[model samples]
Target: MNQTHLATLLAVLEEGSFDAAADVLGISPSAVSQRIKALESDIGRVLVRRSSPVVATESGEVLAQAARRMALLQAETDVALRRTIARVPLSIAINADSLATWFQPVFSEVAKWDNATLRLRIEDESRSMMLLRRGDCLGAITTEATAVQGCEVRHLGVLRYRAMASPALRDAYTDRTGTIDWAHMPTLRYGPNDKLQTNDLDGRLEGKPVNRRVSEIPSSEAFLEAARRGLGWALVAELQGRELVESGDLVLLDDIVSDVHLYWQYWRLESTMLHDLTAAVVTAAAEALD
Candidate 1:
């Protein structure tokens, strides 16, 4: 119920320790503990679980989210009144591929704002929405079109991918009859979370045994480079792979195109900064995605 206590709870969760949060808040560790205790007592529920690095309980998480939203709103109001306020970080989650390609423009847009800062958490598109549910980020670029509770959703567009490999790799896997030996060919995936490569190839096998010869390359640029250098075939984003395809560096393994429909999901708060960011993301997706 107390605004100060709520802020303290949010700070503890973000900083990961009571002492660390105390330093950020310019207060003693004792004061921080007292506030958290007062908050828990007021709510008649334990808000934070005392640990080496304190973690919020399920009920605590709900309050932490509310606290974070309140902080953002207060920061906005301070700026509107021409008061000097510390830069507020707008945390967002995005996939590695999107960061390297269509999402670049969003960074450029954020650079122009003086009152806000960007804190990015790179996760797979499929899992990025988890950050939203956990209140780890204010917004995310995700594969899920369905809105999370207290959030809004917008369909960006499809990011088309092509199954591609080096000419040598393709030739080595192709038989004299022109049928490709997909079951034996090596493949690359961004990481364990990345299913694009395996999903596409597995669909072709139709219950047959798969090669299981897969390499994990986590970085987006490195993943593309590995495929280009003949490490393995992979599903490459069209925007990132087009030049390589044209330059004869990478060849298409098949004509089937994978279309991943992307969406923008954010807290349904009436914040100008969030609105502006959504607009920027929508505009950039329009130009880069299908």
Candidate 2:
């Protein structure tokens, strides 16, 4: 396989268009298209779908991942040989809750490294595996225990969630018998991707879930803030909401807890940067997660 063609494929996928990729490569759009055509002819597979934002076909994904690994290894070699003063980019995906809690220490550790830099994609743990498959990120902190194809997986501990609400809101919705109004009380969610609050509610309620009053608060900080301000109740991460629960700012709705087991999935490559990062993540998770 031609290295130039592989690099062009990656550039098109990353930049989202042939023209954008051509500009980055300092070549004409026709030259970029010709290279892609030549590569497809050589491989006998349709590698790219030329849509509004160009996307990879199934076959393209395999080659794209190969190209990404080659680039990273080349970059690592360059840095190690002091051939260039460039920092090797270590791209990965992490969930919002983990980012707000245990993942903080990983940032501090990365800051001490001068030869590498981070390219983080903030995504939901349940859905980040797609990024890994597309080779958009080299690794991900995901809820999935099974490894993505061509990737290795390690079990990080579970992140526990507690359904919580403000004291005033809980009292306002509680009835005379002390049975909380699960059906009528408003609920907060991080986004459409978030299922923790809904799953918790459905398990506790009898028939027909709550009257579906939900407000979307996508940011981790704001999600907790909405619960604290009585906007709506939400399933908050234990590490993030423990102090609030202790301070009487938020109260648990029930004793039931939602435990999401997390895992680290990364390309099975022998690279020092990845090794150091995995060590840092495992160490932090051991201390923070149950």
Candidate 3:
């Protein structure tokens, strides 16, 4: 297969359309279509589904990952030769809580590498690894410690979460016995994908279901703000909501806390760049996480 054709396929997948990819590559849409056709013909398999926004077929994903690895390798070579690389892609997946908290320092570390162009796909820790499986990202911060095939896992650290509520919300849920009513209080979740808040709370409540009204607020900061404003109670990470919990803006519920063990998973590429990034994440985890 031609290297340029492989890149063209990857570009179409990334840019989501042949015309957009053509603009990026400084070629006409016809040229992009021709390259994709040539690549498919050489591979003897259909690679992309010709939708309004093109999507890679399973076979095409393999080529896309190969292209990404090739680009990463070429960037490393350029770095060693003291040559300027236009953009060395560093696509990664991260959890929303981490993005709202310990992940910022990692961003700073990434900027220290001038050759890298960052791409982030945010999701729940439980689902972030899907990006790696799809060849969409080279690495991810995830809750699963089991290594993906052809990948390695590094245990970063546990991120602790405290169940917090506003003063008024807490009083409404507290009963005459000085014990809190767990079932009636309104609960807030980061999104439909997030089960952590409910999962931990259910376990702590002794297999009892938290049969409460749930509001789905997707953004990390906004979710915390909703909890602070007494809209509902939520699991608050220390890095994002510690101040509110400390300043009496948010009340810790039942003195209970949850620890989420985070792991860094990446393709087992023998690249120094991957190793450096892994080290940077581990170091930042030590500084920020429990």
Error of 1 at 153 (Å): 1.3
Whole-model lDDT, candidate 2? 0.90
The candidate that achieves the highest TM-score relative to the unseen native structure: 3
The best-first sequence of candidates by lDDT reads: 2, 1, 3
Cα-based lDDT at residue 127, candidate 3? 88
Cα deviation of 38 in candidate 2 (Å)? 3.2
Q: Which 10-residue span in candidate 2 carries the lowest summed lDDT?
A: 203-212
**Per-residue accuracy of model 1 over 133-188 as CA lDDT, tens digit each:** 98878899999999999999999999999999999999999999988888888999
> Candidate 1, 55: how far from true, in Å?
3.7
Clashing pairs in 2: none
Per-residue CA lDDT of model 2 for 203-258, tens digit only, reads: 66766745678899989998999999999988999999999999999999888888
- For candidate 3, lDDT tens digit of each residue in 1-290? 79899888988999999999999999999999999999889989999999978998999888888888888888888878878755678888998889888878878888888687778888899888888988788999999999988899999999988889999999998989878777778889988778898687577668875566989999998999999899998988977888997899998886777889999999899988888888888888888988
TM-score winner, 1 or 3: 3
- For residue 74, model 3's alpha carbon misses the true position, in angstroms, by 1.4
Q: TM-score of model 3 relative to the true fold?
A: 0.93
Say what the RMSD of model 2 is. 1.9
Alpha-carbon RMSD of each model: 2.1, 1.9, 2.0
